[model samples]
Target chain A: MAEKVIAGFTVNVTEEGYLTDKTQWNKEIAAEIAQELGIEELTNAHWNVIDFLQKDYAETGKLPTIRRMKKEGGISTKDLYDLFPEGPLVKAAKIAGLSKPASCV
Target chain B: MKKLLILGAGTAGTMMANHLNKKLDLKEWSITIVDQEPQHYYQPGFLFIPFEIYSERDVVKEKKQFFPKSVEYIQAPIKLIEAEQNLVILQDNTRINYDLLIIATGCKIAPDEIDGLEDGWRKNIFDFYTFDGSVALRNKLREWEGGKMVLHLAEMPIKCPVAPLEFLFLADWFFNVKGIRKNVEITYVTPLSGAFTKPRASAVLGNLFETKNINIVPNFNVSHVEAEDNKLISLDGKEVEYDLLVTIPTNMGDQLIERSGLGDELNFVPTDKHTLQSKAYENIFVIGDATDIPASKAGSVAHFEAEILTENILSYIHGKPLEAHFDGHANCYIESGYNKAFLIDFNYDVEPVEGTFPLPGVGPFSLLKETTINHWGKMAFRHIYWYMLLKGIPIPTVPPHMKTSGKKL
Candidate 1:
C-alpha cells in the first residue's frame, strides 16, 4: 500500500485485486477514482494523508484502523461513513490504496 | 437423427421452437434452445410505453413462459459459434452440437454507431426501443411543459417501420389531450426521400402531415446530435432544433453473430435471398431481424416467413429438395391517431395498394385505408400475438401469401 494525500485527505493506494496488495495507478485513473469518490480534486494538503494511507496498507496487510484514521487522517467513523454511503471507511478504503476485506462487503 | 439447436428465445425463435417442438419427435431427435437473457420483451409495447399507454409490466414477460416445455432451455451467454464444426459454445464451456442450427437471434440497438449519439443518448435525447428508455421517456414527458418536439428516425431497417410515424401521430393526440398542443411544435424527421418508402401511401400520409401541421424533414441523414445546442445536425449540416428530442436509435444485429464470423458488418447473418437459409452454412436457417434479407424487418414479416419455412423444414426432414418460395411479405397497421388506423399489406414485388383485404371487394378491412375497424384490428392483435403467434398456432383469415383481390388496377 502507498499512503498518499489525495484531494486534501489521507488515502492509502495499492495495487488492484488484492485486499492488501494495491497497484500504483497513474494520475488519470487516480483522478477518475477520486471523481467517483467525490474528491474530484488532488491538492497538496491531501497528498500526505493519501501517501501515508497507501504506505501503511502496502506495508501492512489491511487498511488503517479507525484509531489509526483518527490519529493519522483526523476523520471519525461517522465522517467516514458519510463519504462512503456503503460505509465510507470501507468503501473509500477500496479506492484509498487498501485491501478489500472479504468480510467488509 | 441430427440434433437441432436454436439460438435466441425472442419472437421468432420462441415461435419456431414451439412450431418445431410439436413436429419433431423427441424419441428420434434432440432439440435445444440457447438464450442469454431470461426475460422476453413485448417489443411492440415499447411504442405505447412513452405515451403511458403500456407499462413495463405489460411490455415484458419471461422467455421461459412462452417457450415450449419439452425443449431444453439453456439460459446462458453464448461465447462463440464455430459454424464449420457445427457447434455453439457457451460461456460456461458447455458445447452444443447441432446437425441442424436455426439462428432466430434478432437485431439489437447500436446507438454508438453514430457520431455524438452517445453524448445525448437517454439524457438529452431518447429512444423508445428499449424498456428502460421508453419508461425514462415516459417520466420525462410527465414533467415536460411543452416546446419544439421531434420524432425522428435515424435511418431505416428499424424493427417497426411505422412506429416512428405512430409516435408522432400519438404525440399530437397526447399533446392535445394534455392541452399543450399549441405550446409544442411537432416535427417528423427521416432519412427517406419522401414521407415513407411506398409512394402511394406517402402521398396520402404526406398530405396528412401537411394538414396536421407536423413538419416533415425528409431525406435528412442525421450526422450528430448537439445536445447543449438542442439541435439535430444532419450529414449536410442542416439542423432541426428541439426542446424534447425523441429519436429512434440505430438498430443492428447481435454480437454473437459478429463473434461467429457469419454475419455482415452490422452482425446480421447473410441469408439466402429467397430460401431463408443461412448462406454461410448449409444446415443453418435464419429468420427475422437476424437475417440480412432485403425485406422490412417486422413481426408481420416473421409471421409470413414462418408459414413458408415450416414447409421447407418439413421437406428438409424428409431429405427432399428445399423450397425457394418466400416472397418478402409484410403487413403493418399505421395508427393515424384519433381512433383510426390504416392497414398496409404487400410483398417484395407489390407495393401497398388501396383495396379491401382478405376477401377483396367484399372484405371488412381496407388496405391503405383508415377506419375504426382497422384501429380495433390493431388493438386486437395484442391478444392474437399472445395466444396465437407466440404459441405457433395459425392465424385465421390472414395467410402467409398476400392476396391482390379487391385491389383496383
Candidate 2:
C-alpha cells in the first residue's frame, strides 16, 4: 500500500520530541531509521528492499536473503553493508516494519 | 428434521455458523445464532490499542458484518439453556426449542471476580480485552509521563493468553518512542512460573524480558489489588506497587452457561476433549472459550476446533461415530517491541519447539524465534482473520493441523 500522504506536517518531530509520534510511521522516524541504516534517500537501492518486503507472504516463499539482496543490488561482489551496529536483521527488519524475529531478540 | 442453535456471535460462534451454514442443507436443517451484542471486534488488535497503533476503528466492526447471510441471527440476550426440554429462554422469558445446541458463548473478563478490581477498574486499572477498556487504557498511556507500570494477568484460561506479554513488549517500544523507557519501570506479573505457560516458551520469552530490561515477577498469585494505594498484593503476601496498572482480569464463560446447569464452577461448559460434546448432554456441543478444553484460549484454537467440531457435528447428525481428532493446535505471534515479533506453533501433546513453520526447513517465516518475517506474518494475520478464517475459508496453503513438515524437531 502507498504511504498515506496526509495534509499538513504538524511539527515534524526530531530526536528531542521522541514521544510525539512513536506508534506511527512519520517522515522523521522513517528518515531516522533510514539514516541509522545508511540507506541513501529515495534511491532504487533503498526502494528495492522496501518494495520486496512489502509483498504478501506465505510459508513457502523464500525470504530476501543476504545473497539475493546483494545480487539484486547489481554489486560486483556481495558486500555485507554494516548498516546498523545492532545487527542487520534488527535494523533492516525494523525499518521494513517487520516483526522482531525470535532469534534476533 | 433437527435444528441447530448456536449461542454467541463472536469468533467461535461466527466460525461455527459459517462452517455449518455451508454444509447443512438449508431446506431441511435450520440454523439460528443468538448474541446480545450487535458488533464484532477484532480482538487481537486490542493488544495494539494502548500503543496507539490501532484506534478503535481499526479493531471493531459490526457483528452482522461477519455473520453468514444464511444463518439467522437472534439479537437477544439468553436467559437460560433448558437442556432437558431442548429449549433456550431469552431474557424476556420467551423460549425457542432446538434439537441440537452448539454453545459458542465465549468468555468475558470479570474484573469484578478479583477483589478491588471493580472499584478501581477503568480508572486506575484497565484491561484491553474489550474495546471500551482498550480505548481508556490508550488514553491513560498517552497522558502518562513515567512511572512504575504493572502489566498483570489476573488468572489463566483468559482469551488470548499471549496478549499481556505483547503489551509489555509493545510498552518497551512505546516507552522508547517517548524517550521514557528507562524512566518507566515495567514489571510483568503473572501467575505462571515464567513469562508463559510452557517451559520452553517461557524461556524464550524470559530471554526477551532480559533483553528489553522489563522486570518479570512470576508465580505471584494475585490475592487482590489495592488500586487506591496503587499496589498489588499477591497471595504469597508479596506487595508490588505500581503507578499505573494494566490488568487482564479473571475470564469466565457466559452466565447463561451457569444458568443452563451445563457448566462447571467457572461457567465453562464441561466438554469432552476430543469430541467437543458437552459432558452433561450428548446433544449439546461447546467450542471456543465456552468449553473447558485444556488448550490456549486463542482465536487459532477456536479456528482449529471449529474445523474438527464441524466434522463431528455432521457425523453425529448422520448417525456416524464422532472423530475424536482435535489436537488442541494453536499458533500465536508474540509482538516484541521495536518492530520484532516471534511465532509459536504447537498442539496438545507437542511443546512449542524452535523451528521454521508451514514449509518447515524452507520457511519465509521462522518459529520459536524473533524475526521481522514473523512480525510481518503477525500483521498479515489481521487481514487473513477478516478475509479467510472467519469466513470459513482456509488460507490457501496452511492446513488446520500443526504440520511438522517445516518445523524442526
Candidate 3:
C-alpha cells in the first residue's frame, strides 16, 4: 500500500491508487486530487457529480452507475465524459474520495 | 478394423471424438485423437482473465478428461500429414495410418507476420488469446499506470471475432475500478470499416464505443508495428500511436496443414463450405478454426459444424451420399461491461438481428441489446462447454442451424 499525504494527513491507497479509507477524503483533498488528475479547476458541474456520488455511496454502499448518474443525478453521459474525460463514475468516485467500486469488468 | 484419426484434441477434436464414440461400431472401428499439448482450454474464458472476472485455473483442464474410455489419446505434436498416403507422421518420426482423417488442428496467432510486433511483445504489447499471454496481460493491466492503450486486430477471420470488442468494453470497466481510467486514453483499431464484421452488429457496437468514450480507428490494415515510435503503421500509410498495444495478431491454421500441402494461402484447409469435406481429399474432413470457411472462427461454429460433420462422416462410411450440411451457424455472447452483455446469433447468409433468443417472445436473453440475463448466459456457458457441448450432449433449444423464428426482421 502507498500512502499519499494531503494537508499533513496520511491516506492509504491500493497499488492501483484507489483510496483505502473513505473518511480521509475531504473537499480540500478532492481539489488537490482533481488538479493532479489534470482538472486544473473544479467547476460546479463537477461538484454536483462528486457530491451526488458521495451521498449515493454513503446511502447505498455502492458506486452509482452511469445510467443512475444520467437519470437521477441529472448528468448526461456526454457531459459526464466531458467532466471526467477518462471515465465519469470512476473519476467522480475518486474525486469524491470513495473507495474503488466493486463492479466486475 | 478401420481406424479414424482426429488431429488436435481441442474443441472440435474433442467433440468429434465424443460424438463418434457413441455413433460408431466399437467392434469394427478404432478412434484416436492426437495433440501435442495435454491441456484443454475453455478458450472463451481467456477473455475474462485480464478483467479479473475469471482466474487461470477456471479456464484450463486436462485434454484427457473430456475423452471417453474407448477413444485413444496420443500426446505428441504432429510433424506432417501425408494426405495422399492417408498417414500422419508424428514429430518422433512414427506414422499412424488411417482410413479417415479429421483435421481439427486449429489456428494460432502468428506475430512474426507483422513486422516489429515481436520487438515489444510482452513488454509494451500483449495478447489475451493464449493462456500464458492472458496471465501476463492480467499482471500488466493490474499494475498499468494510465496511458494511451490501444486494442488492435491485425486482420479478420480470427478466432472469436467479437473478443476484441469484449476486451475493449472490459477495459473501460477495468480502468474504472482501478481509479486511473481518467489517465487512460483507450482506442480500438481494426482492419474492418467498423467495430465488427457485420454491419448491424457494428452499428450497435459502434454506438457503445461512442458512449464509452473509446476512440475507434477502423480500416487500419496494419503493415507493421514501429515499436520505437510506438506507432502501428497501416498498409495504406496511416498510423496510430499508443503507449500499450494489445493486439490480436494475424491468425493462421496449423503448420501441419501447410506441411500436408492441403491449405489455402493462409494455411487454412480448403473445404466444401457446407459439407466440411476437404476439397482435395475425399476421406478427409476439416472443422473448427482450421477450415477456410466464411463463418466466424468460434467454438459455437465448431459445435454446430461437429453436429453436421458427425452425420456426414457416418453417411460417407456407409457409402451413402452426405445428407447433413453445415450452415456456418455461429452465436456468441458479447460482454458489454458493467455486468451486462448482448447475444448475437447468425449464419453465412444472415447478419445479427434484434430480438429475443431461444424463445422468441419470452427470452431470458436479448439480441443486439445488453442485459444482465445475457451476462449470466455468458457465465453459464463455461459449464455448458465442459459438461454438455464437449461431451456431445444436445443443447436444448439451441440447434445447429440458424433459425429466424425469433429475430425481428
Docking class of 1: incorrect
lDDT of 3: 0.85
Q: Every model's DockQ, to 2 decimals?
A: 0.01, 0.01, 0.01
- Candidate 3 lDDT over B71-117, as tens digits, reads 99999989999888999999999899999999999999999989999
Top model by TM-score, which number?
Answer: 3
Q: Over the true interface residues, superposed, what is the Cα RMSD of model 1?
A: 27.4
Point out the higher-scoring one by TM-score: 2 or 3. 3
* iRMSD value for model 2: 18.4
**Against the unseen true structure, what C-alpha lDDT does each candidate score?**
0.75, 0.75, 0.85
Instruction: Sort every candidate by lDDT, greatest first.
Output: 3, 2, 1
Any idea what lDDT model 2 has? 0.75
lDDT of 3 by residue, A2-88 (tens): 897865668987654667788777788888778877888899999988988988666544565554576667887668778876445
- TM-score leaderboard ranking: 3, 2, 1
C-alpha TM-score for every candidate: 0.77, 0.78, 0.79
How would you class the docking of model 3? incorrect
Q: Assess the local accuracy of residue B124 in candidate 2 as a C-alpha lDDT between 0 and 100.
A: 73
Tens-digit per-residue lDDT, B1-409, candidate 1:
6688889888888888888888887777777889999998878888888888778888677788887778889999999889999989999999988988889889977888667766777776888888888999999999899999988777556787778878888888888989999999999887654566445666556577777778888756677887778888875567999888888867788998888898765677878756788877888999888987767788888888877777777777788888747787888888887888888888766778788877778667888887889988888888788878988999877888878777764
lDDT of 2 by residue, A1-105 (tens): 123322233333322222223245444555555664566564555455545543411221223333234444342211223333223333444455443222111
The regions of model 3 sitting more than 4 angstroms off are A1-105
